[model samples]
Target: MKITKLQPTVVAVPYRSEEVWAFGRRRGQISVLLEVSTDEGLVGIAEAAAYPSVDIVLAVLDSIEPLVLGADPFEIERLIRRIDLVGTWHHVRATNPAIAAVEMACWDIVGKACGQPLVNLFGGRFRDEVECFYYVARADPDEVAAEGRRAAEHGFRTCYLKVGAGDPRTDLDRLAALRDGAGEHIGIRVDANEAWAPGTAVQLIKEMQRYGLELVEQPTSGRNLAELAYVRSRVDTPILANESSWTRYDQLSVIRAGAADVLSVDNQMDGGLLNLKRSAGLCEAAGLPVVKHSLGELGVALAAAVHVIASTPNFRYANQAYGANLADDVTLGYGGGIESYSDGCVAVPTEPGIGVQLDADRVERYAELYRAEGAAFAFHDDQPRGEQAPALPKR
Candidate 1:
């Protein structure tokens, strides 16, 4: 069917609990949802990442509407290339997320038309359920350790903790506490968010080995491939590269340098599901296991990830599906609204076209939240001095 319209809207949803990271504290997430409607009355849905800002995502989506409005939803790659061509080279970095969301909607439409799940389009299903990890945003050692225990109580096998928030001692104490609290059975992985120097990462990681870290992700700046390689060589724990790579060229550089032992892949980062599959294929060919990244996404994005990871053969690490941490969700009727976590894993969506239907009432409610409170909302770096640091909440 021919494309009919591209609709974009903002929604603000509260977090189930407050989270603190190196950046700051926040209690909710804001995301832009895009719906692509076809001539035959089918609508495809997707959500874009709005981390640093949501305005950027909206502007990109609005600017690219012309490129997507009249195209065939099934000719996904052609539509993507057209959007890229019109927007120019720099546009890829700036607007690929918007394009990625639109592409996902197209895939949803395609899946519905074919009467198949998105997993089938991603090279068939590899497993019925995909494993996930509980995320504890950067916090004090005791708080993080407590969350780790809760993760195990909730049946998670792995706990993902944010690191590099403060001094070396911060991470050391946090890791030690998490290991003790989570017990010996739970696996712990830490993400530094490119906050450390190679030297610092090396020294700290060497010490963290005692706690049995599953991996240390993106310890150094993503651009410093040589440094990543050096850290990987010096450390016994596997190094996972997240911010360092996205496109094929970036992957090529990382592969050539032997930068990291594993690569973290995200649908939005790679542009769309097809690109994600291609990126995973590259990692698979290189014999590196792939891990999924989370940006505190909601159900739409989380469902998309689950379908992709479930179909991927080398997705060894637990997929980062942090939507479960959200206090409420806007979509429903897709395996408990994509927050169906139990025994450390979530079942893949079996229904056609990503298998999620929007809860109209919730959407309107959150959209109202966006309209009324969007301007007042700002991320950690955006807040002024005096109001910058908020106390982390205790469970």
Candidate 2:
């Protein structure tokens, strides 16, 4: 079927918990959604990772529409290539979140046309359900510990805490409390979000070893593979490369440098599902485990990630998509949808074409919120708040 229409809508939804990032903190997220419809009456839906620039991403959707308007939806590679050729520079870095979104819609259409689940297109499922971790978003150590215990009580096998955003000593203490609450059974993974220097990361990660860290992620900046390698050498914990390895080429560079113990990639950063698969393939060839990084996605993107992760044999780290933790989602009808966190894993969507149906009403509700309030109004991560302020003591 020939592709017919491309629709873009921006939505702002509330977060279930306070989210702390290296750059900011927030209680909700603003995301862009795309609906790709074909002449045969089939529509594929997807979400793009657009933070801080919903309007820019909306404009990007308009610009890239011509490249795939009348093309074959099933010709995923050709369509992506044509879109890239039209404006190669636009696809660089996380700026291509829209490109990835459109590509995902194309895949959904192809899967629906073939009457198969999207994972089957990627090489079929490797596991029945995709395992994930509970990501603690609060800045308080007490809250962090409580969340860790709650996650374990809910059956999660791992807990992820964002570190390096504030005081190093306090972050360390928070991690220690998380370990204590989670006990020895739950795996603890910390993401520094490239907020630390090599020496600082080495010192911090070394101290964190006492609590039994399963992994430490992107302690230094993404550009410093050598520094990441240095941190990796000095610490006993496995180092996961997130910001440093966005694409397969980046993965190759980090792998060659012996910079990381694991690779973390996301569809938004790497371009699309195929590129994410290629990134995982590179890690597999190098005898390294590949991890999926969530870009605060809603159902569409999270479902796509589950499909890719299920089909990827090298994927071993806990899958995450904070949308699952969102108080409400703009979509519905997927087997488990986005709020399906249970038994420590998410059941893969079994329906055709991303296996999720989008709700036009809910989409409009959030879209109105986006229009009236503006994207920035929905962003609360710009500054420290509540327990995040006054910088608490360590130990």
Highest TM-score: give the candidate number.
Answer: 1
- Clashing pairs in model 2, backbone N/Cα/C closer than 3 A: 25-381
TM-score per prediction, in order, is: 0.93, 0.92
For model 2, residues 1-395, the per-residue Cα lDDT tens digits are: 89999988888877777688666676666788888999999888888877447777888788888887898888888888777766664345344788889889989988988899999999998988888878888468888888888887888888898887556777878888898788899999998888887888888888888888899988888897888999899989999999888777788999999999999987887679999999888889899998898778777788888898999898887876674457787768431223476667877889887988878898889888877765453445444466444221111
lDDT of 1 by residue, 287-323 (tens): 9998887666778887887888888899998877765
User: What value does the lDDT take at residue 339 in candidate 2?
Assistant: 44
Model 1: residues with Cα > 4 Å off, grouped in runs: 89-95, 333-339, 375-377, 381-395
- Note each model's CA RMSD in angstroms: 3.7, 3.6
TM-score of 1: 0.93
Worst 10 residues of 2 by lDDT: 386-395
